[model samples]
Target: MSVTVCLGSQFGDEGKGKLVDILANNANLCCRAQGGNNAGHTIVANGKTFDFHILPSGLINPKCINLVGSGCVVHVPSFFKELEALEKHGLNTTERIFISDRAHVVFDLHQLVDGLEEAELANSFIGTTRKGIGPTYSTKMTRSGVRIADIFDPEIFESKLRRLAHGFQRRFGELLKYDLEAEISRYKNYREKLVPYVIDQIPMLNSAKEQKMDILVEGANAIMLDIDYGTYPFVTSSNTGLGGVLTGLNLGWRSIKEVIGVVKAYTTRVGSGPFPSEQLNEIGDKLQGVGQEVGVTTGRKRRCGWLDLVIIKYSHDVNDYTSLNLTKLDVLDDFEEIKVATGYSFQGQKLESFPANPETLAKVDVTYETLPGWKIPTTGAKYFYDLPVNARKYVEFIEKAVGVKIRWIGVGPGRENMISR
Candidate 1:
C-alpha cells in the first residue's frame, strides 16, 4: 500500500495544492486530515483556477475519491458553497466526495464567537481567518461541539447546540448576538441534504488499506501553525503535522510510505507572529508583489522574507519528511542576490533549535547565507539540468542544509510548470 502524506513545511502557503493535485492523478483515494475552511488551497489546471477550502483538491482528478476526515471542523454551509462552485465548473461530484460522520460541525455561532474573540484580543489577536475554525476547535475540545452524526438526530443536535450557544453567550454577553431558533430551522433543512455525504471513515480507510490503494493525505495548515509544536498562541487550533494525519484519518503510522514536505523558495506568513526573517522593506515588497503573496482565504498580504532553513530543520525533526518540494523559484528571478536564514542568535548566543516562545523567537537575530541570483527566469526550464547554474545551486543549498533530497521544483504556478528532479 502506498500512502503518501504531503504537508506544508513553512508557515503555510507553500504551494501544497499543486503538488497534491499532481499526485492525486495516481491516487485512488485522497483525504483531508485536519483544519477547516480557514485553510485554503488554490489549484490551476486545464486553464481554470479552482480554490479549495473545506474540500479536498483531489476533486480536480475525477478518478480520485475525496474524504473530509474526522479531524476537520465541518462548516456545513461553506461545504455546500464549495461543492456547488465545483459543480458550476463542470466537475461531477456526485458519489465522489464524503464527510466523516464524526467530524465536528462549525456553526455560524462559532464564527460569531471567533470575531468576538479576536475583537476582544484587539492588537494581540491570533490573526485568525475569523472562519470559526478556532472557536469550533475550542468547542470540540470542551466536549460540547456538535458532530455530523448528531445532526441526524434533531432533538440531540438541538439540545447540544443550545447548550453550547448558551455557554458562549454567558462568556461574550450581549456581544454574542445570534438567532438560535433561526439556525436550528436552517439546519433542519441541512439534515436531509447532508445525509448522503456523511460516513463512517473507519470502514472506508480500512478498505483502502486492505485493497492496497494508492492513498494520498493532504494536510491543511503547515507544521509551524500546529497548536502544540508551533509558535504557541499564534498557531492554528489543530495539529497540522504528521501526527494529525494518523489521528485525524484513523490510520496507523505504518500506513504512511512517503512524507513530502512542501517548502517555498522564500518564506511568507499571513497573520501576526514572530517572523525572524521577515523583510519589511523593498526586498519584502518585491517578493510580495512578484510571488502574489496574498492569502487565498483571508485576502491579507503575506509577510515575505528569505527562506529560513532553521524552521525547516525543526519541522523535519517533527515530521521526518522523506523529501521536499521547493516552490516559487521563479519569483526570485529578478533579484541580484538571494539570502537564506541558516541560524538564529538570541542575546548574542546561537540558539540550538527553534524557540518555543514567540517572544524569544521574535527577539532572536537571524544569521543569513547569501548567494548570487541567477538573474534569469526559471519558469521556462522543464528539467533540473536545464536550470541556470546559480538557480541549481540555490536549490542544492536548501537540499544540502535540510539533509533531504529535492524531489520536485516548482518554477511557475501551473501544474505543468513543475520540474521533476
Candidate 2:
C-alpha cells in the first residue's frame, strides 16, 4: 500500500536493481520516475543478467505491474532493443508492462546532438552515455518536445518533429557543424516504430493509484550526478534525485512514503566528474577486480574509491533518505585495513559536512578512520548479526555517522546474497 522510491546515494551503479528486485515481491506495481537509456539498472535473476535503461526494474516480478512514468524520455530504438534482448532471456511483455503517454520521445536527433556536443568537447567529455537524455529533457522543458501522445495524433507528431528538426538544424549548424536535414530524413523508420508505446500518462499512472496497488518509483543515475545538486557544469542533464519521483509521477510529495538510498560499499563513478576518495593504489584495483565494477550500459571502466561517509551524508540530506541498502560489502573482504572517510578538511577549515564548491572539494584532504578488515567471508550471511565482527563494525560505523539504519546489506553480487537488517 506504500510507494517506495529508491535512488543512488553516490554516483549511479549503486546496485539499485538488485535491491528493487528483492523489494518488488511486496509491491504490485513499479514506475520509472525519470531518465532514459543513459541510465542503467542491472538485475541478476535466475542466473541470467538483464540490465534495463528505459524499463522498470520491477519487470523481474512477473506478477507486479510495470510502468514508465511521464518524466522519462524514451529513445525508441533502445527501448525496443531492450525488449527484444530480454526475449532471449525468456520474459513476455504482455499486459505486465505499460508506458505513459506523458513521457517524451527521444529521437535520433537527440542522440546526434549528444554525440555532436561530446565530440565537440573531445578530451573534455562529460562521460555521457550518449542516450539522448540531455537533449530530450531540454526539449521537454522548453515545451517544444514530442511526447508519447504525439504518436496517436499524426498531426501533432509530425508537427513536433518538424519543429524539433528546425531547432536542431540551427544547433547542428551553429554548434556541431553538421547538416541535420539528411539526418532527420534517415530517422523516418524509427519514428514509425515508436508509435505504439506513446500515450497520455495522467490516466495511466492515476489508474494504478486508483487500484491502491503499489507502484515503485524508480530512478536512474545518482543524486550526485544531478545537474542541480551534483558537481555543476560537469553533471548530467536531468534531476536524478528524490524530487524526480514527484515530477515523474506528477503526484503530491506526500504520496511517497519512503525513499531508499542505495550505495556501494566501495565507490565507483563513470565519465568525468569530481571523485573525492579515488585511489590509484593496488588496493583500489583489487576492489574493482573482485566486484567486476564496470559500467552496465557503456562497459567503461569505473573510477574506484573507498566508502565515503561524507558523500553518503550529503546524499541523505538531498534525497531525504529513509534507509540505506549498502551493496558490495564483500568487495572489501581482502584488505588488511579498510579506510572510511569520516570527515574532510578544506582550506584549514576542518569540517564534518560536505563542501559546496568543486574547487574546495577537490582540494580538501580526507580525514579517515581505519577499521579492522573482516578477513572472514560473508558470502551467505542473511542476518545483520550473522556478519563477521569486522563486517558488522563497518556497517555500524556508517550507520552511526549517517544517522540512518543500514536496512539491507549486499554480501555478494547475486540477488539472493542480500541480507535484511
Q: How many residue pairs clash in all the candidates, one count each? A: 0, 2
Give the worst 10-residue stretch by lDDT in candidate 1: 246-255
Give lDDT tens digits, candidate 2, residues 1-421: 5688989999889999889888887788888878888887888889999888888888888888787888888887677888888877898866777678788888877887888878878887887888888888888889899887776675667777878877787767756544445545545665566556555667766776787777677778898888788876567777899877788886567678889999899888888877878888887788779889888889988889898888899999999889999998988888789998888898788976676687787888888899999788888888988899989989989999899998999998788899997
Tens digits of per-residue lDDT for model 1 on 237-318? 9999999998899778888899999999999998989999999999999999999999999999999999999999999999
Best by TM-score: 1
RMSD for each of the candidates: 0.6, 2.2
Give me the runs in candidate 1 sitting further than 4 Å from their true place: none
Per-model TM-score, in order, reads: 0.99, 0.94
C-alpha lDDT (0 to 100) for residue 130 of candidate 1: 94
- Model 1, residue 306: distance off in Å is 0.5
